[model samples]
Target: MSSAQCNKSAITLKGSSEIVCEYLDFGINSILFQRGIYPPESFKTAENYGLTILMSQDKEIKEFLSVTLSQLKDWLTQKVVNKVALIITNVASLEVMERWDFNIEYDGDQSQGDKQVSDKPLKQIRNEIRDVLKQVASSVAYLPLLDCLCSFDIQIYTKDDVNLPQEWAETEAANIKNAQCVKMRSFSTNIHKVNTMVTYKNED
Candidate 1:
């Protein structure tokens, strides 16, 4: 019996939004560290969700992520965005090598107002997050090792009417070539459910 099948406790709308953003913060930092996007010394590990996770300490990166996640939280509560991706590309060739996609699903009637919580337990949600982070920590075992210079971009999908943030530019979806997609564990906040998947260039 998987933990995900357990009972879910209800939480308020605000709580659900916070959970999504928090997961994004941890997920981004973990992926950046695991995929070798930055120097190892730039990250420090902290205990979270019953796991030791590496988090970024760089000031500029920190600010960037905060702003992005803050904006994302609003959309999340409104059920505006559907998917977000952390894309890694080769610096010289401009080729996408890997993509970590987090798919957002929701089922709450926002018209009823923002005070409602999801029907899932908070503990159950955390366990699901832990499972994905564990997979990220062990990614090297299955993901191909990259030897080229790489850079990453955080791209999200939203409708055109979404008030565009000045810093965000519209770009085509960046996908990997000959990709192998691995489905990862997901958690939900009743109002918002997030599912994760990782795709990398199939070297085989």
Candidate 2:
């Protein structure tokens, strides 16, 4: 199919679910015209729109877009049509805490001037929260059916000035980055909790 046609189809299929039957000609047209890439005329038919069109289908391009258009191509193959379903789950009601206990040592004038005090640094506190998040993710990663959960949408809710142990927060960030199919959303729950919804689109 021509680049314009493929782009049109892709846009049409955008935001559709796995089981939905829809035409994606609009998406295909948009991608081609927007990117200014033109495909040969030989591929410009309804049946071959998805197969014969190619325009910078590189991994770097896919990551840059953050939407995985190329990967969507594989999923659009004849055999995989309507065979996928995205599952969404919530991990709420989590409580985080920070400890104010630590040891600090300084040597200086005692009676005449200063005294030694013990406290944790802000960096250390952040690291602690990151560690906790890592622990939680580690556990979550090991579930027997986790592989089936291809995409993950993570939402972290907390209170204001809530000093989450640094480690846990960092770990959570890393997990979201490493997930094969995942999206992360963060919110402050003191005012209200937030919810997210996911929907998939298929190309015909």
Q: How well does model 2 score by local distance difference test?
A: 0.26
What's model 2's lDDT at 189? 13
Kindly provide the TM-score of model 1 when superposed on the true structure, using C-alpha atoms: 0.90
lDDT of 1 by residue, 9-63 (tens): 4577767888888988998899898888899999999889999889999999899
Best by TM-score: 1
Candidate 2 is scored at a TM of: 0.18
Best by lDDT: 1
Residue-wise C-alpha lDDT for candidate 2, range 1-204, written one tens digit per residue: 696654543312122211111112222222332223333331233322223233334444334333433333333321132211212322241211100111111122223221221122324423433333233233334222321212222222223443444433422311111123222231111111111111222111
lDDT of 2 at 139: 30
List residue ranges in candidate 1 displaced over 4 A.
Answer: 1-10, 108-113
lDDT to native, each model: 0.85, 0.26
